[model samples]
Target: MKWSKSSRTLRRIFTKSSIGQNPTSKGKWGTSLTSHRNKLGTSRVISTELSPSSRRFTRRMPFHHNKSKKEPNGILHRSQAYVAFIDETFKGTKRVPRFMDDNNIVKGREAQRWIVDTALEMADAVRHTLGPKGMDMMLVDRMGNKVLTNDGATILKSLETKDPVASIIAEVAKSQEQNAFDGTTTCIVIMGELLRRADELISRGVHPNAIIKGYRMGLSQAIAWSEEISEEKEAYEAGVEAAKTAITGKSAEDFVDILSDICSRAAMVSSPSEMMLLTVHGKPEDAELIEGLVVLKGPATAGMPTKAAGNIALIESEMAPPQAQVSLTDPDQIKEIVAIQQAFLDEIVARLVKAEVKVVFCQKNIDSKMLQLLRKNDILAFRNVRRNDILKMVHALGGQLIADFADFSKSDMSAATVEVVESAVNDYVVVRGDGIKAASIVMPAPTEQSGEEFQRALEDAVGVSYLAVQNKKMVKGAGTIQAQMSYRLLSGEGCATADNSKVEAARRAFAEALLIIPQTLAESAGMDLMDVTVKLGNSPGLGVNVHDMVLEEMNVFEPLAVVQSAMSGAVENGVSLLRTHSIIMAKPIQEIFAEAERR
Candidate 1:
């Protein structure tokens, strides 16, 4: 519920936000307090204060009244204030109209200005990381670890902050990343602009409700425009170009053609959320897409064959030495115990060999003795495998996982193929079958750190490119779709069969906000913003050629679903922030006095 202009300022403080999100604190709390005294010499500061159980604010606004009897300037005599005309049973106390409490209050302009400005500053931080010519952000952690990349998700997640507003902005970035994985920077930019435009409207004597209404209308039209334009025509290699656009921001620029081909092939056999990301230590050009699962670990022994194609045995439990249960009082007893355990382990291997299983995947570590036995028998045993990877391998091969040696029989085996190839990078195992539904996009980097950056970029590109293929179309990129939506929204030529001039102020604000993407791209690339915007006329296929600085059709494209998702998330973030008239900070009793210990 919204509080009135004169309502008391928000009460209490807490470690959590209203959206139920917990931000990474970076070992610090982000809080700002403002206060002032009224002309009557009483404080009306906006800060935290202790309250008794009865005075604590609840979910509903608290009623503060009936503490005084006399009206101001003696306007009401005793008879008028008493109201003796009503019957005794019908009498009820009234809350007299009052200004903000002498203790707490937050004005509209003050709250709106700061929140909008803070959001804009965050947007600016990521603005330069958009489009082909965008630059990367070199993020250094507290331990002096360096990460150099232009991926929006990487940049936002790498830096942690304690401020509530920054936390909320992080949520916006996360939503964009999880939903589409493309257009994260675009979504954040639009959200900040929405708030910026909203602040201007509030300053221009417009009600917040009106601004909200107009924004909703504009958002609806933006989504509709995105859907209507659908996909760009497949004139020539459109799919390749769209995939390239998704990974163009310097992270994969050196070999986007090969990366695009690999991403497209991986998408054919993998689910969007289940796609695997594998990083190997080598050159960037060694990237490959396997139509199967990568265990991320190699065989247990170097003597084992690098390639194995036969019945597979998937072990879910550890393949280690026996766990001694009885205390040995003499050396003879200990020797007997060790001999018995060794025989039992040998029998398990013998069973696999009899079942014609040539390869084994152990979920847990394998003892060195067992590895030597498997190597001598020409069996490829992959040890220390992750549980998730084990599950994927079993599912891909259409086999059942056996947790115990007794439970593993001929029925548990499945026909499969596995390869342990050695490249300039580390050795990794690839498991495949006749009908596998998983795939891995492997990228080789000069160092482990750069490999991480490449993996991040591939993840973003894969999701968006897959979405475009699923939606059956794409829109011309390089600011083409946004420019069309802006013209349609502001010129009043679309969005209805009737006039929408009543909310023109809000609609105009939204339209101008759409241009920020193209304008920012131009300025970052050292080109004239006005010239770029003019070249990006109110046409569907018209977009700026970033390299040539000319206005023409480049056949560039991105998924429509990405744009729609970004718009939905950005608007939701902006509207929620706008509806917040005051922030109620809540803190626990212990934390209230946590600092006193240090004193």
Candidate 2:
């Protein structure tokens, strides 16, 4: 029943009770309980005060047992009692019963504070590794493998954290790295600074909604100002500058010119999709770019020729013979099966020889017998090649990938020159001939860790170069663009509806938040942050020269996509973090698994 109707019914039932009637009208000092109940009838008036017996009646009725039947002694039905109790006790309040432990739940301002703090802590881990003067961090995994670098994405991904907020920040940094290719640290630092400003605003009683609105306005204005200040340079010049800017603060810093040349040339020939990395054992100065496919694997057998110049073939299946469906119990049947397998191998080798195929790349392993046959034919074959490598080689060498060895023919082959060069660590097979559009950068380093680090640097360099070439737009780096964005935001040059004080406060906070990048750069370079930020703020084309700890006209330019990508990601994630009002930490999955196993 509806609460209003149930309430009226309850009131009538109470009025008809003996205790609700006038005591004087009853006239008997000691009336029997049965007589009193029999005389109970509907009355217009209800007793303002409840009697002891009526109180006992209400207390004995359990609100939870609302589906039960009516009881004796004129007690109302359980549903009516339940409705009346609910309407009288909690009509306007929003309080709910506690079903979760207080320790695992963080609510209201406390949850917001926790989120901001956790994100800031994660950002701090990569804060110092921001600019040319930035320091590197040594990350050691559980297996005792160490990685020493200043790359923001590397540091964030390598660190272990249980906090969900930290994970979210790390994911945002990773997204920036993937999309912009060179702004992970800048993204995280901007996000952290945004959160810091938001925390301050919240302490002063500003609503988070106002903060989100202000941040959105600030992001649009920053993007617009960035576009206005961007300069278009030739693809080659921009590619070289972008590469040098990307490789400024890593182990490859000393070889920035050489690496930049390699990166620019590779990017000019082909986009990042057609580029690859080949690591070798040597010094960083020995790095070079090859205008062909480079496979780290060599010939499958020692007896095969290490170098061959002829048509190329790609195989997707293994070269081993297929098994017979039935068991061979008789010696004649076994011999027949062996002969069929031998015939299969011989047919494959003969087909390759007929096609004049001298270089073969297979996706799966080749049988020992097949390897011997190819060696006798003087064909260079590499077995167990990766599927990606096979596809790349097909694209670079103008060959078709054959699904089955039985289907191989002269039409599927393409002419190419292949050679296996032995290095200190391993052998590399270089394929250079027809259809050589793709290029690979052969990077050299002394140790495995250093090689890996150099590889990361080369990746960023290549990525930035490709972006710069594709976009053809560049901006001044080293805090110049950030300073300009901050100045424009605070000046309210484009914002027409900047009226409300709370939103204005939030907008100002956003403007200040963007200055964190320049501030960080100045601090890392051992210059006065205020002085450097002031100089850059006044000058449009001047940037921080970390080597000399002075503000000068910097020739360093970064791709416009990098700056825009980082700002957009930081603002979006920062607003998302601020909108969170509650955090419920669930039990760890490992603990849940343990409980399930025990059960």
Tell me each candidate's TM-score.
0.77, 0.77
Query: Roughly what TM-score does model 2 have, to 2 decimal places?
Result: 0.77
Candidate 1 lDDT, tens digit per residue, 158-217? 658755666788888988898887888999999989998898788888777778778888
In model 1, the worst 10-residue window by lDDT is 81-90
Q: What is the clash count for each candidate, in the order shown?
A: 7, 0
Q: Runs in model 2 with CA error above 4 Å?
A: 1-104, 306-310, 323-337, 354-356, 395-400, 406-415, 422-424, 493-497, 537-541, 585-599
lDDT of 2 by residue, 1-599 (tens): 11123431233222323332322232122211211111222111222223333321111111222223434434444233221122222212122111233355657876787777666767777889999999999999899988899999999988797667878888998898889888999999899889978988999999999999888877887898899889999999999999999999999999999999999889988777677897888988989898877888978989788888989888898878887579667999899889999999999889899998888888999999889988888988999998988988777767788997756689899888888888878788888885688888999888888899999998999999999998889999998888878877777667544577888888788888888888898898899987876776677457888889888887888999999999999999999989988777777899999999999
Q: Which candidate is the best by lDDT?
A: 2
Model 2 local distance difference test score:
0.78
User: Could you tell me the lDDT of residue 151 within candidate 2?
Assistant: 97
